[model samples]
Target: MSHAPDLGSSAAPGAGAGQREGLGELFSSVTEDLSTLVRQEIALAKAEATQSGKRAGKGAGLLAGAGVSGHFVLLFLSVAAWWGLGEVIGRGWSALVVAAVWAVVAAVLAVRGRSELRAVRGLPDTTSTLQKVPSALKGHEEENHR
Candidate 1:
């Protein structure tokens, strides 16, 4: 019994060693490669974004816990200061002093927070790269025409 040649082999039937691939075949191969590359790139980006999102979520949760712990520390310190002063200057005046101190702290925090918010610049690099995309595409098209 004789076996037939494999259809999946690189050598096509009736093609000689000197033969080159047709334009249609070359174009088809390039298109397929480009499509696969785009799909792989998208998958990579999605995986990266998912990993970043999980990290951000975990960081936010830890920060919230830190905030609560900090608040309790401040509360206990404030109470201790008030009680210590009350023994010296009396209860009413010590309470007033604590309230005034907190008011000043609040004012300072509000001013600093506002200034920090004003300094925020959002997504500058992403915006710049996105703006360049159209020009890049135009350049590619011009090259193809040439």
Candidate 2:
């Protein structure tokens, strides 16, 4: 969290009454501020992720279109090869056999991509850092008391 101006003093802006706040009040204020800060941080991260996701989606769509264009190039080459093979095999059977092989390759690639996507995890480092915060604060407090 960023450095914030002291909130314990009654002289601070938005302070009510002409008396200093107690320790409990100070702790409450700090906790409330921390909660607010965390909420804001989460909101910012979510907004960033949403924007990044939009950009990634657009990029993926463009890539898919490119892949289709490349596939057509390959398809033409495959057709030419199939016509050559048609000299030994029947023309209709040659086309069907090539189509079947292409279908199998596409299915395998699609399944692998799905599995790779599923294997990915999010926010691993952030989660570990957040888990350590309380222990880190406790050490700081112990040092302060000593």
TM-scores for all candidates: the values are 0.43, 0.42
Among all windows of 10 consecutive residues in model 1, the one with the lowest summed lDDT is 137-146
Candidate 2 RMSD to the real structure: 13.2
Sliding window of 10 residues with minimal summed lDDT for model 2: 137-146
**In order, how many clashes per candidate?**
0, 0
In order, the Cα lDDT scores of the candidates are: 0.56, 0.58
Q: Write the per-residue lDDT of candidate 1 for residues 52-123, one digit (tens) a residue.
A: 566555555545554554565576557757676767756645655665665555555545545544544444
lDDT of 2 by residue, 37-67 (tens): 5786577567666665665565555456545
lDDT of the structure predicted as candidate 2: 0.58
Return the clash pairs for model 2, or none.
none
